[model samples]
Target: MTSVWIMLVKKSRAILGFAAISIVAASCGTNAPQDTWQPKGPNSKIIDDLQRPVFAVAGIIGLIVAVAVIYTLIKYRDRGQPIPEQTHGKPALEITLTIIPALILAVVAVFTFGAIFKLAKTDDTEMIINVTGQQWWWEYDYPTQNEFGITQPIISSGQLVMPVGTKVLLRETSRDVIHSYWIPALNGKRDAVPGRVQTLRLEADAPGIYAGQCTEFCGLSHANMRMEAVALSKADFAKWVANQQAAYVAPAKDSLAQQGEEVFLNQCVRCHQVNGLMRADGTPAIAAPDENVWSGSAPNLTHLMSRNTFAGASFDLLSKQCRDEVWNAPSDVVGTKYLAGVTEECLNQKDLRSWLRNAPAMLPMYANATQLKATGGKYRGMPYLALTEDDISKLVAYLLTLK
Candidate 1:
């Protein structure tokens, strides 16, 4: 009997040791980048506060439970005696158990509520960026900035540019369905509902690029609806704003770019707008009305080459090594490399060619010929304008000059 008990104890100890080793090995094997957890903004402070106390309390509770379990196991181990008396539960013991847990919960609730109110207070925001969500894309409007002091709103898409360390308040809404705007490194997710304007606060303590995706599934390409928030130094942000506000520069006369512009006006202008071009009488030409288009917002490709990626930042603007080289470096290095704007060096020509050929096919969308039959055969997101190889080349040439 003694030998059998010794063998059982040894086997149990071996199993426990194996379990511990497996847990440690599994934890070490996780390969997610360690740099992701480091937060660099005001909103990150809220994340820190919320996680810290919860983890601390959980750690304390876990330690207590572990110690109690070990003590009970050792103390109550089988001994050479009859079974101990099993008594009914004591009222005092039950009351103490309930009261302790309740007290701990109350304490947690108090701290959690305090933190919620602190983070929710958005009274002192200096600027507001109106973000409108749509199917498979995002549109940003700087309602605070006046264009050349003319008070015309500055609107763009795909990239959300902001100055570093400045508190930015986002007023978000959706056009068709519910969508969520979430940049995990910076803050919590905020839902953009169709009829209501929801507000979220964002701040970047350092100048760098942060990637985001739509948390709410909207349509065919919800997974493809990605975005980037670029935090720049004040001066660089001002420069970006100036460049964005600058009047469109027409391609040189009689160039391939000029031909591309003509092609765009003839075929693409019905859904897109190029700022500088006008009618022969020097008057603005209105885009042909397409009621099927959502919010009349297409990505403003003014500085197309200036950005690192396009088409919702789903594809890399540069080669894989180039992107890794930039993103892996520290903030200072990344800021310097990406600040100038997108250039030919970073352009993904293959994907660009594919996109110019047929955008809906390249990226999934509900813009098929059958889907558009209800809307008088008009394109929903983007049309597959039947362009010859020559026309595609010309259009791509014109798009490249947008920078």
Candidate 2:
């Protein structure tokens, strides 16, 4: 009997050890790109270091309580023994437990205060980017980013690009409802509220992609409002800036791409803009999106193919092979490989074609006729364009040339 009891204890310990190891391994998962446990920068590191010790202390306290309860249960088990009369609780023991918890809470309070101060220091910001949240997407604009050898203003959606080893401050606001921007690997969430600009400091220690989402429930398509921060090395970031600022070259005359350009001018020019394209009267064809879109503007597609993802970073633009060369490649090669965005042979045409056919069906958008009627005839996202298969083919050809 004694040998059997000892063996049972050993088995229990072994099982617990295996469980602990498995849990640790699972916490370091590679598939959860937005796992808060994986801190990639200073902001998230502050949060992790502050909370982990507190969690450890709490776990220790819980284990001590559990052991005490188990010991008492075994020691006081009934074995045809006399029942003890009920008595008043021990005042001293109660006092001790209360004091211990108060002390622990007090320690937690002090460390929490220190972390708040450390996290609040954002004066060292090297760049400022404006983030505007709307019904279904986020738009990022570099206001004073002269680094990366970029002298002109840069605007982008779906992907937020910043140079590695620098502090990028986001001045965030909303045009419609409230939305929260949270990139777990880099920093905590900050709310984007209408009429108020909130600030959050972001910094990346290395070059990679950090995925984020709108955590706050803002609208019907809130879950689909995803974003990615693409960190690039200095030289590669400069190359990206130069590419974005390069002159817009029109498609060759009489080519299918030029025909698609004409189609875009007819159906898409109201909301989308290809920079430097002129109207028939030679007037600059500035897009007037307020007439069609609810947010009063749309994503600029001037260098559309220069980006990797589309439709709020919810879809991949490059083929699997090219995308792997960017996403799964080594750090030294990531920047150079990603800069070569969406080549013709590497374009993912199937999804893009479907998206061009019916954008609202692909992504949740308040753009159907009934919803538009209810919302005073304003569309909250890209509506179905009812494009023919031939039109979709031509438009894809033209958009491919925008790079």
Candidate 3:
């Protein structure tokens, strides 16, 4: 029995040694990628700065605790001697411990309050972008575009484009439930409550595309709700604004696109709006009627092809190879070329075809019309629009011309 016990101890030590080696190997693995803490905007900078002091304080506290534990383990260890005397209390030691932690906590509170106010300040904002959150999509409206020569409000979806180095204020709110807007590399998150207007400040130091997802769990498709902020140089942003402001072009005469336009008016016009298309009142229907969407309205797809991604930035605007080719380029080259907007070459024909064929099947949403009826004709998200193959082809052809 003694020999068996000795063998078990030897086996345990061997296993412990192997585990230690594996841990060392994992820590120094050559294949491990370096962490990329990319900071694109001002809010990220503030967060990073605040985190540094907190981490420093935590490190100091951890080191002190570790040293004290090691000292106690060694000093109080048994050495085949008499047991040490039991003390009632050490008042001075207890006071030191309590006071030290209280002082540290007070310092932390001061730093926290300063950061909170700094992040929430929005007094010097140059522009205000009204951001509306819906079930699984985002709407961006330039409310004061009239001063910039735009006759009406410029609205778009999926991507938020901002001029780099500008302090832009975001007035965010939700249509239904609560939603939170977050773009990690660019800024901190802010909640969009249904009845409350929350202001968020955002500024990108340089031109780049930063990705984010909805941090609030609104519903089933909450995980799929994503967004991107495209930070462009002032000149490039101006050019984009001009392109977006351009009047919508009609489909060519005697083309299948013309028939598709008729189909769109018959079926889709109720929910969507294409500029230059006239309503029954003979006025150009540039905006979706306010009552259409459960939110304010669906996105204006007039410049749909101008943005690279769509469906709330849930799908890529370009193919994988195309995105990589653009993203892997040098920084200066990448910023100008890789804005999340559609180009003539990178359009996803297959996905777009499928989306038009059956949008609900392509992207899961609360869009089943029959199921909606079961719930007393109430649905929060987009509903399915049954369309024939011929209708889908015509729709795709028409959408292609949007570019």
Candidate 4:
């Protein structure tokens, strides 16, 4: 009997050791872009600071409890002995346990309250950007700010761009189902509720990319609803604003890209907007997503190539080499590499072509005619356009010229 008990205890410890090793290994992921511990801004730092000590306290308490339980079980083992101490009441012991926990909690509450207020402070905001969440993507609209040379509104999707070291206030709201905006490196999660506007403060300590995702389970493809924050130097951000506001340069007359533009007007203009596109009748081209999509909007692809990712940042626009060149570039040159945009030589033709071929096939979305019943003859996502091979080629060409 003693040998059997020893064997069981050894096996239990071995299993527990394996689990502990596995957990530690998993937590040490080398490419954890969404790592909460690796905070890059003051707001996130506050969260990280609070979390570390709280986690320590919890771990210590858990360890103490486990040790006490094990010690008590061993020291009071039956061992063929008679039961002892029928009475259970112990006022002094109960009181000590209660007071100790209360004191610990009181200390934690003081720091937690201070951190909440610090994170909520927004009186010193240097910029304001409106962020709207839809079914599976985030849309950012930079309101005109004379200080940044942004004379006109700039709309972008998938990627939120801001200047490094500047306090950016995001006015968040949802267009359809409830969603959440979170960039772990910059700040905490903030829900984007419909009919109500919420604000989240964000600031990046350096120029780089930070990964994020919609935390709330809004609908299908919630896991794919990802976003990225790109922090650029003030000068680079000014240049980006200028590029976004610059007049759209028409594709060369009668070229392949021009033909692509024609195809775009015939097919994509219904839902996608390409700023500065003019109709043959000299009318400004506009998109009417409200009539087509239930969400009432689609990603604005005016400067498509300027961004590295597309389709809710779920697909890469640049090839691996090109993407690495931009993402891994030094802080000073990252802006220049990003501004270069997608060129023919650097485009990730596989994903881009596949996306243009059939959007619903690549990403789960309610684009089928049958699925439209719930949305009142409207799409919850992009429907198949059924473009020919020639059409896809032309469309790709035209989209590349957006930047």
Q: Pick the candidate with the highest lDDT.
A: 4
What is candidate 3's lDDT per residue for 131-162, written digit by digit as tens?
99988889898875543444567788888988
* Model number with the top TM-score: 4
lDDT of 1: 0.73
Sorted by lDDT (best first), the order is 4, 2, 3, 1
**Candidate 4: tens digits of C-alpha lDDT, residues 1-403:** 4565566557556655755675465446565888877899999999989997897788668657755755566566668887776998899999999999999999999999999999999899999999999988999999999999989999999899999999999999999999999999999999999999999999998888899999999888898999999999998888888888988999998888999999999989998998889998999999999999999999998989888899878888999999888888888898888778889999999999888899999999888867577788898888888989899999999988888
Off by over 4 Å in 2: 1-23
Q: What are the TM-scores, per candidate, against the unseen true structure?
A: 0.83, 0.91, 0.83, 0.95
For candidate 3, list the clashing residue pairs, or say none: 307-341, 307-342, 308-340, 308-341, 308-342
Q: How many pairs of residues collide in each model?
A: 3, 0, 5, 0
Over 1-403, each residue of candidate 1 has an lDDT whose tens digit, in order, gives: 5565556557656765765665455435553332224556877667777776776677567657655765565556676768878988899999998999799989989878887887687898867899999877887888755522314567777778888878889999987789999886688789999999999988998887777889898878888888788887777777777777677788888899889888887877776666666655777645653454644556655566666777766676666766776666687766667665555566677887777788878888767757665656655577576788898888877887887
For all predictions, the C-alpha RMSD in Å is 4.3, 3.2, 5.1, 1.9
Tens-digit lDDT string for candidate 2 (1-403): 4455456557556655765675576567466878878888889999989877986787667557655655565566665788787888999999998998999899899999999988878888788889998878788877745555657777788889888888889999988899999999899999999999999989988888888999999888888888888889988888888888898898999999998988898888988877887766777778877887877878888888988888867788888777777888777888888788888999999889999999978888888756567567878888899899999999999999988
Q: Candidate 3 at 301: error in angstroms?
A: 1.0
Where does model 1 exceed 4 Å of error? Answer: 1-36, 59-88, 146-152, 279-281, 288-290, 372-380
Candidate 1 has which clashing residue pairs, if any? Answer: 305-342, 306-341, 306-342
CA lDDT, candidate 1, residue 28: 54
Model 2: residue 134 alpha-carbon error in angstroms? 1.7
Q: Is candidate 2 or 4 superior in lDDT?
A: 4
**CA lDDT, every prediction?**
0.73, 0.84, 0.74, 0.89
